[model samples]
Target: MKYLVMVQGTQLDYEAMRGKASPHSPAWSEQDVQAMYAHMEAINNDLSETGELVDAQGLAEPAKIRTVTLGDDGKAVITDGPYSETKELMAGYWVLECESLERVTEIADRVTRCPQPEGAPNHPVAIRPIQDGAGDLC
Candidate 1:
């Protein structure tokens, strides 16, 4: 089955990495960030070697996002965003072709342990199976 693993974190987490300051801990040293990336890269390499990783990528900061909605006049209304209403944001995702949800969960568990700044809370990775049949759409 193909599954998507959505990596979630708060806006503050992104800002902390960018500004070298974390709300949950002291400023992140350059080495700390590098180490984190190294850990993540190792995971990616493992997954790729196993032929389970389909794709993976991180997103730009939330502030760079734009929200578009249809206005009363039926025109598109665009707004800048950090999506202040929400505390959590999707930071990245991985698409994997795996044997089962159980296997995917195991992978997610590993991701939850990836290095981050001290005091940072463990974030959840939302995992869902991709629909493969027309019946699934209904």
Candidate 2:
């Protein structure tokens, strides 16, 4: 089965790039932001090399969220982004192909331990198994 591990946190997990001097900016030579990106990329590469990664990427800021709600007419009403009131919003996700929940949990632990942007706490990840109707996903 395929599982999607949701990586989310209260503070911005990708905040490492914010306020930090950009490599492109001429005035800033404070730190190496590219190294951070490299770390993130390394995780992706590791998953790809192991053939467990199905798909993965960081999500857009939740503020840009758009949710669909049902109107009185039974039609869907498109509302502004981020319906959830909690500060803990989904920030990114990694989809992995695994045979057991334990395996998925192990991978989740690895991701949770990954170094995130400065000032960001370790994000909580939610794991849910995906259902492909065919059932022969081996």
lDDT of each: 0.84, 0.69
lDDT of 1 by residue, 1-138 (tens): 999899987767776776556556556667777987997899899999999999999998787789998999999989998656877788999999999899999999988888776776677889988998998888
Collision pairs in model 2 = 65-81
Model 2 residue 62 distance off true place after TM-score fit, in angstroms:
0.7
Candidate number achieving the greatest lDDT relative to the actual structure: 1
Q: Candidate 2, residue 97: CA error in Å? A: 0.8
Off by over 4 Å in 1: 22-25
Q: What are the root-mean-square deviations of the candidates from the true structure over C-alphas?
A: 1.6, 6.1
lDDT at 8, model 1 = 87
- TM-scores across all candidates? 0.91, 0.71
